[model samples]
Target: MKNKALYTLLIILVQSLHTTALNAQRSTPTEQINPYRIVERCTLHGISLLNNLDTYLSGYNYTGAGYYFNHENLRNAHTGNYNWKYLTTFSATLGYTKQQSNSQFTLLASRYWSGYHPFRVSNRLQLWTGAQIQLAGGALYVPANGNNMVSVKMRTALAATGIAIYRLPVRQHTIDLRYRIDIPLAGIMFSPEFGQSYYEIFGLGNTHGVIKFAHPLNSPSWQHTLSADIPIGNNTLRIAYTANLYQSKVNSLRTHIYNHSFAIGFAKTIYKIKRKDSMKAYSPLL
Candidate 1:
């Protein structure tokens, strides 16, 4: 594992060095156009319609808390045993971002979801799509349920992604594609007091595995999701689906269940924010 980490770092270092050398060779000592002017041709800040379906990728850095209600655990409170049903598990998320345009840094902490639900209102950032390399980290809190025994499950995950988005892209705007991974943060525990008892009901007889979660367990818990947004003028229609492809559950005492979501939502584009001064300075002259 250590060697693998070293190898990955080495590869990245080499790639960066190679890119720098290439950029040096391509450098033109002439004046560079203002980014804002180049993109300002479109009326919107950086959003337009997706005339062609190009690649889309988005990543946000998160530092918000959310609650997840495990229906199975709730059901066991009355049934007194484990089950295989996961319906509605809710979690709130808060994220920060240092965004990029093309291959350059542009925005820093431009926008984010609110503490409560931010979906009720129409946010322009939610409507368009673009391709980018994203890196995110966040936590999920599962409330403590007594009796049957369920701990406050905290988890974090990471993923490298590529997206093929279908939007009406007219300007230099950002968009969301699909969440390809919710990699298992670790082999979590579900109230050890009641966990062993719960495992017995699952026919495991006895459970023997790692008792703790390795903070950001660098394990293979890859997953995938699909979501789309169809634009109709300023308003849009959206539908999304997500599910787990791999199960890296480490429930030694209790049973763990994951659910698939098929959600239908609406999106609309509003006034785009003004272009930053730096961006405008880089725009090309007509």
Candidate 2:
């Protein structure tokens, strides 16, 4: 009886050791799912309309290109869901009209704080409202006018911005449709008189009230952009159209510039490492 009991105890010990060794070999690995920290998009614009107006009133139609860069940081706070966006754009147009040749170069920078709200229209719909601070400075060179050959422009304003976004899911593909608009409320702009020359302002030190306060009533300007994103493999393709309308009357000189651009670009997502049980990748739907 003692020998039989020893054999059974040995069998049970060997079985326990085998089970433990298998478990150790098959242990799960530690994984982490992190969020995208940065996103970069490059766009090439085809400008179709480049129109300008002065006392002589002329219009030009041609093709021009520009670049746009944007950075967004998102965070959830106790107050609400908010994000910060910084954008910069540089564009130049060169063309000629019946009256004269019109060329313009524009540089703009804007920073905005946008808060997202759930839209009742649908579960996939969202609306964002925010305030933006922008600084825009540019120059327009009209070759016809010997007196005012170059028009120097500087504008800074606090503007209101809004965005509407909707997502559509088709099988395994998702598409994002979004429209954004900005209107300047109030700010300061620099303009010269009807016949004032640069030599008079800087060379002769005759600058008085060159800086004028601007509002929608006086300087009505609007900027609108409509864009769509479609996923292609791991990256996204963006198609967009942008329209800019600017008009202001200061120092007895009337100015208006209208620009329309069609843009195509690619979107990329940036990711970071997180510590968790299983490794995964995460990205925003928009």
Query: Whose lDDT is greatest here?
Result: 2
Task: Assess each prediction's global lDDT (C-alpha) against the native.
Answer: 0.31, 0.63
Model 1 quality (TM-score): 0.32
- Model 1, span 1-286: residue lDDT tens: 9999999999999989877765654354234542222210111111111011001111222122112111100010112442221111222222121223212111111111111111212343322121112122222222222232222233333223323333335465434453323333333322233234434533564544423453233234443446655554665455555443322224323222222334455544332224553244333331
Off by over 4 Å in 1: 1-146, 149-151, 166-211, 214-220, 244-248, 270-286
Cα misplacement distance, residue 118 of candidate 1 (Å): 26
Provide the lDDT at 72 for model 1: 7
Off by over 4 Å in 2: 1-44, 56-121, 272-286
TM-scores, all candidates, are: 0.32, 0.68
> Which residue window of length 10 is worst by lDDT in model 1?
47-56
What is the alpha-carbon lDDT for the whole of candidate 2?
0.63
Q: Which tens-of-lDDT digit does each residue in 91-177 have in candidate 2?
A: 444434233244544333344444443344677888766666767766665555576667776888888877777888978898988
